[model samples]
Structures are given as C-alpha cells and as structure tokens.
Target: MYIPKFLEKDDVIGVTAPSAGYTEQVDLTKLESAKFNLAEKGYKVIETDNVRKCEKGRSSTGRTRAEEFLSLMDDETVKYIVSASGGDFLMEMLEYLDYEKIKSNPKWIQGYSDNTGLIYPITTICDMATVYSGNIGDYGMSLWHEGVKNNLKLLEGRGIIQHEFDLFENEYVKKITGYEGYNLTDKVEYEYISTNKAENFSGRLLGGCLDVLIMLCGTKYDKTVEFVRKYREDGIIWYLESFDLSAARLQCALWQLKEAGWFEGAKGFLFGRPCFFMEEYETDFNEAVKTALDSLGLPIITGCDIGHRPPRMTMINGLRTKVKFDGKHLEMRYTELDGK
Candidate 1:
C-alpha cells in the first residue's frame, strides 16, 4: 500500500469542497480562522474557487469539484488536501476524478463522513492510503481543542498514539461564534461488543461512515472484495461509524457489506459512536451492530473516538495497525511508519 509523505514545515494544505461548500457567514468565518491558524503553524493554506459558495447544497458541478481536486494533486507544493465540508453529493464527483493521476501523485487527502466516497475508492481501488479525520473547518476554533491538535500532529507525521478522549459531543450544537470548541457532554468508553472483557487485535486500518460506505458497496468505486483479499496476509481491522441511519438500515447495510465479501480477511471491528441513530424494534446502536456482525465472533470494539462525534482520532486508511486494548482504554500503533 502507498502512504503519502507526511506533512513538513511550510508545506501547503489545500482545501476543496468535494461534497458541499460553506455559504453561511458563520461557516465562512470559521473557515477563514482555520486557514489563519494553519498559517500561524507555518503551513501555507489554499482553497478552491467553490469552497465558500454553495447552491442547492453543492459547491459547483461534479466535474468542477473533480477538477479542483486534481489541480491540488498536481501542485508540487500542496502536500496535503482536506475537504471543506461533508454532504450528500460527493459521489457525483467520483466518476470525474482522475484516478490514475491521483494514484500517481499520491498526496495526503483527508476528510470524514461523505468524504468516504473519495477516500474509500482511493484506498481500495487506487491502492493509496487516505485519511479519515476532521475537515479544515474544525481547526477554526478560537482555542484549538485536543481533537484539532491531535489532527495536526498526525498530519505532521507524528503518528501519535491516540488515547480515548475524555468526553464526546452528544448532539450537534449550532455554531454561534463560529470559533467554538466541542460541546462535550457524554463520557467516552470503548465498549467491547462481542465479549464482556477487553481484547487486543489489529490489522490493516479500513472503513468509514456507513451512510456513505453503503452507497459505494456495489459501485465500481468499491473494490473492497479485491482490496481485502489482496491484503489478507495482514488481515483487516474495520473501524466503522454511522450518521443518521436507523437500526434496521444499519443492520441491513452491514449484512450487505458482509454478503458482498467486504469483510474478507477481517481480524476485528471498531465502531465509533453513531451521530444519529433511530432505534427500531427496541434495538439500539450496539444491538444493531450485534444483529449483523456478532455472529462473526471477531473482537468487536464499539464507541470509539471516530466519525461525526467531536474529538475523533485521526484514522489512516490502508495502514498496518496494532490496536492495544486493556479493558479501560485503547491505543493505536502504526507499523512501517517512521515518526511514531
């Protein structure tokens, strides 16, 4: 697997909206502050033409989004790229992406949620690693929180051993100052689903938002079966999460992925907290996961610091990983990485 070079001092970080662009004044303010913060940290920041423009929930046309992404990839100075926001239409721009060019260039592309449309395809089909983390806007907080700092540290090739965060945001809070930190409410716990006690397991890091991943399961972009098979020797540790999917839908989606052979060579599963889960038939998030994946008997860890919940860890897709869990907490270690 190809892992792009980590960020260095003075390297440029390009921001583009592959899914949706910011239109609200508060959003624009946060975006600008984020850019300024990165600049203060000695990294150059650049944005595409449509980052601040949104119409019909799109930054521009699909082709234009692909074009801007390609432009950043071609730029020798832009070592890393991030999405402006996550929305429903990222898949529309996938077909237009220059896959070959991206594979050849191999820059660090980072985003979460709808961005799975890009990162998933890039890692599984293109065979290059990508990042699943916060978008550029999160860094705009007047006081950078632990999540924001950890994200930047990861980009710098620090390979920090991310520990479980103390708390997580339970619900989405409206942006008032546009530079607000996470309104943390719930305590974080890496719950063991398949077993009552903690278990340690690791493999190639894979997975993303179920809402987006389910959309790509049968599409051409989804080379999941092939990708997992090819990396069977190392196994696969799926770190998954969901956004706004009901218990029934999540169960079906998990079944769909499993039937499609997406879980080939799986060692274990790590599930993050679901952003908005509509319980069905008295089934909760953990129950939905158990209803589908429990039969596998793999060491399933749930309620991790990942996905739409604030203060998520920086996840690297396609990297060999080692997860150490000791009942109370879990720490991730990357293999074949330099700066750990």
Candidate 2:
C-alpha cells in the first residue's frame, strides 16, 4: 500500500468534473465559495477543463474527462485533486485512464458516489490513496461551517482523524445558521441511526458505497478475495455505506462480499449509517447490518457519519489508518508517507 503524504500549504488543489457533467449548468457561486474556502486556508485552487466542458447532453468526448484527470495527476504542481460532483459517466472513462502515470505520481483524488468507481480501481492498480469526501455539490456549498472546514484541515496531515455527528432538530435552520448553534446528543434514537465504537486495528483503507462496489464486482475493478489477500500481505481495512437501501438489499450485498472473500483478509470493518427506503418500514437497518457483519466474526464498527450525511469527514482510499474501538468510543488515526 502506498501512503501519499498530506499536501503542503503552497500545493495547488485541482478541481475537475470527471464523472457527471457540470459545464455551465453548475452553480458557479458554489464553486467560487469552495474556492474561497480553500483560499482562506492558504491553498491555491486550480479549475480544470473537465469542469467547464461537461454538460448534460453535450459533455466532453468519451475519454476527454479521463485525460483531464490524468493530466492533473501528471502535473507536478497539483498536489491534491478534488471532484466537483458525482455523476453517471465516470465508469466509461476508466479503461482510457493512464494508470501508469497515476501510479508514478500519486496524489489525493477525492470524491464519493460515482467517484468510487474510479477511486477503488486506482487504489488497486496504481497503489495511490484516494478520499471518499463528499463532493462540491454538497458540503462545498457550505464551506463556512467549522465541521466542514475542520474536516478539510484534518486532511492536511498524518494522524487519526476523529469526529462525531450531532444532528439538529431543525436541520435546515442549523445548516444555514452554522453547526455551532446546534444541540448534540449521545442517545442513539432517530429514524435512521447506527453507531460502532470498537480495539485498534491497522490496515490500508479500502471501500465505498455498497451499491457501487457491488456493481464493480466481476469487472476489472472488482476486489475479489484473491485480490484482497494479495494486498492483505500489507494489511486491509474495509469501509462501506449505502443510501436508502432495503435491509434485504444490504444483506445481499454483504453476502456478495463474503462470497467474494472480502472478509478473508480484512483486518477491520467500518460501516456508515444506513437509511431505510421509507418511513413505513419499522425494522432496524443498523441491527440487520450488524447481524450480518457479526456472522463474519470480524471486528466491526457501525453508524459512522462518513457517508450521505451532513458534516461528512474525508477518508482516503489507500491510506494507512489506525482504528481503535473501545467499548464506548471509536477513534481513527491517519499517517501519510514522506514522498508517496
């Protein structure tokens, strides 16, 4: 596993739209807001052609976006690359990517959702770390929040990054007012809630949305048991999340991973909160997932606020994270390599 070092203050952060079409339809104000946010932290933001040219019907040519990403990776001055948003087209460009170039010059490739298709395979083939950070369309629109800014700050170094969620009664008001005024809770009672706080286990982080990972199965990007075992010689930690999936669908996905041998060499398992399909379903989605993971006898942590949630934290794909789960609390630490 290759541990890329945290970017320096002067390093340029490249922004691009590699999957979905942003083009002129994107909210320029939001993009500027994100740029200002990075600038306030004393970093440079470089927008790429991919962002400007991507449109719903007349987006860049087949491999244009992939080439743009590759160009950014090859540029020595661009230290970190962030996706503008998750879209439907990233998978088509995967085969055209320059893996060797990315492998040679590894840097942070950050995004979630459709970005997972790109990140998962990059970790497997290029041996470079990627991040599952929420995209510009979501958290980037509210860059003033401490949770959002601090999460970005955490990405600037090598250490375990720790955080907890405190949902507000009026989430909309709290979102507009900033997270500082919201009331926090320790009780785990909500329409959709899951929590896992577990022993310190160390491994290279690998995982993304359960649905996306499932789609990649049996393809070139699939991380089969044999593939994971080969990487396990170094160590492997898996993280997963789902959005509004049924308990049965979640269970089926877990079973698929189990059959593919994902659990065979996993050092630790981490899960994001599970949201149900509808309010009518009274079954506890968290408990169902916990039961599935428990059957594997692996050290598991549930209900982490890393996916499809407010104030989401950034998690690198191939980076080494030190995860400790006490009976009541869970902690995660990250360390970056000197030269990547």
Candidate 3:
C-alpha cells in the first residue's frame, strides 16, 4: 500500500462534495463551524465551488465532482481532502475519476458513509491509504470526543491506540441536528467472539460501510480480491458497519461478499453498532451475523464503537495493525509498515 505523507501543521485541507450537494437540506452553520474548528487546529480549509451546489441526489454533476476531487489530489499545497459530507450517490462519480493520475500522486482523503465508495477504490485500486472516519460536519461538533481527537492525531502521523469506547449515540440523535456534538446516551457494549482458536491477530486494515461495499460488488471498481491477494502475506482485518440496513439485508450483504471471495484470506472481523436495524421475521442482528459469518471461523468482534454511531474510532485503510479482544476489552495498535 502507498501511504501519503503525514499531514503537518499549517497544511491546507481541501473540502469537496462528491456526493449530495449543499442546499437547505444541509446545515450551513455546522459547516462554517467545522471550517473554523479546522482553521483553529492550524490548517487552512479550502472548499470547492460545487460543494454548495445541489442536483439530483448529488452535489454537482458527476464529472464536476470528480474533477474537483482529482484537482485537490494533485494540489501540491493541499495536505488532505475531505468530503463536506456523505450522501447517497457518490458511486456515480467513480467512473469520472482519473485513477491513474491518483496512483501517480497519492494524497490523504478521508470520510465515511457514502464516501466508502471512494475510500475502497482508492486503497484497493490506487493503492493509497485513506481515512474512514467523520466528515466535515463532524469536526464542528461542540464537544470533541476521544474518537475525534484521535482522528486528528492519526492524520498528523501520530500513532493511535484505540480502546473500546464507553458510550455511543443511538438512532434517536438525528444527524440533521448538527454541531451539538456527539450525544453519547447509550452505554457501550462489545461482543468479542473468537470463532477460531486464536484470540489475537494482526493484519492490514480494510473495509467500510456495508451499505456501500455491497454496491461495489462485481463492478469494475471491485478490486478487493486483487488487493487481498497482493497483501496476502500481511493478511486482512475487516471492520465493517451498517447504516440503516435491516438484519436480513445485512445478512444478504455478508452472503454476497462471501460469494464474491472477499473473505478468502482473513484474520479477524470488527463490527460497529448498526445505525438502524430490525429483528424482522427471520433473525436479529446477532443471529444474522453468526449465521452469515460462522463459516469463516475467524475471531469476530461485534458492537464496537465505529461508523454512523457517535464517538466512533478512526481506522486507516491499508495500515498494518495489531488487534486483540478478550471478549471484554478490545485494543488496537497501528504501525507504519509500508514506508510510503
């Protein structure tokens, strides 16, 4: 994997919208607050022209969004490029992007939710590292949680030691209410089930929102198999979360990935609390996971703090990592191994 340079203080951070554009639906106050917060941290925030534009479920025309993102990637002064927010149709911009150009000039770009479509291809195809964490609005939150702090530290080239979080925000806290900070009302709970014999392992980190990964399956953008094979020596540790997927849909997504050979050479699995899920008539989330993944026989840890939930941990794609869970406490250590 090709890791970009560690971001330094005074670096320029470019903000763009590759998915849904800004409109009355977006919270402008939170975006301004996030920009201010980022500037206060010693970095300049620059936004693309179309970030505020809205169209048919996209921030701008697919070509325009891709062009802005690629331009930022090629900008010498910009140390990082983060999406203004995640939306429903970022996948549409994939084809318009210049992957070869990106491969030649890899840079740090981070976001989650719909941004998964971008992160996965960048790492798997372009071979560059990307951060899967909060979006622009998240930084503007009134309270800076440990997860948010650690995310900044990681981007600054500092190592991170992640622990199971103490609290998480449930679905009741609607995302539309921005800048209030993460209202972690629910007690954090974790389930570390070692289906395999070993309880501890290490591998190259991969994965993103299940809702997005499922969409990339079988597309030309699907390079997961090749990526895993290239890094087969290092192995893969997949950490996935859902965004409003029902238990049945989650199980189906897992089954699709399994059929696509995504979990062929795996070491462990990390799951975040699903933003929204239902027991349905078939099974609950727990049963869906067990039934779908029991065949892999890997150490699977579920209900950790990650994805759409509040106080989520940041995971760097393509980073060599060490993970261990004792059915109670989960710990992770990230190391710079590729020397990029």
Compute each candidate's TM-score over C-alphas.
0.97, 0.83, 0.95
Model 2 residue runs over 4 Å out of place are: 23-26, 57-59, 137-143, 158-160, 168-198, 223-227, 275-283, 335-340
For candidate 3, lDDT tens digit of each residue in 1-340? 7888888889999989988756764367777878898889999998899888877778888888899998898889998888887889998889999999988887888999999999889999998999899888778887778888888888887776889888888755555656687877788988855457355899999999999999999999999999999999999999999998898898899999989999978888898889888887778787788888978888888897778887878889998999877778888888683232
Q: List candidate 3 stretches off by more than 4 Å.
A: 174-178, 337-340
* By TM-score: ranked, best first: 1, 3, 2
lDDT of 1: 0.89
lDDT of 2: 0.67
lDDT of 2 by residue, 268-321 (tens): 777776533422245466666765677655677766766655455567787667
Candidate 3 clashes between residue pairs 3 or more apart in a chain or in different chains: 21-59
Per-residue alpha-carbon lDDT of model 1 for 16-37, expressed as tens digits? 9999999999999999999889
lDDT of 1 at 293: 92
Q: Looking at model 1, which ten-residue stretch has the lowest summed lDDT?
A: 193-202
Q: How far is candidate 1 from the true structure (C-alpha RMSD, Å)?
A: 1.2
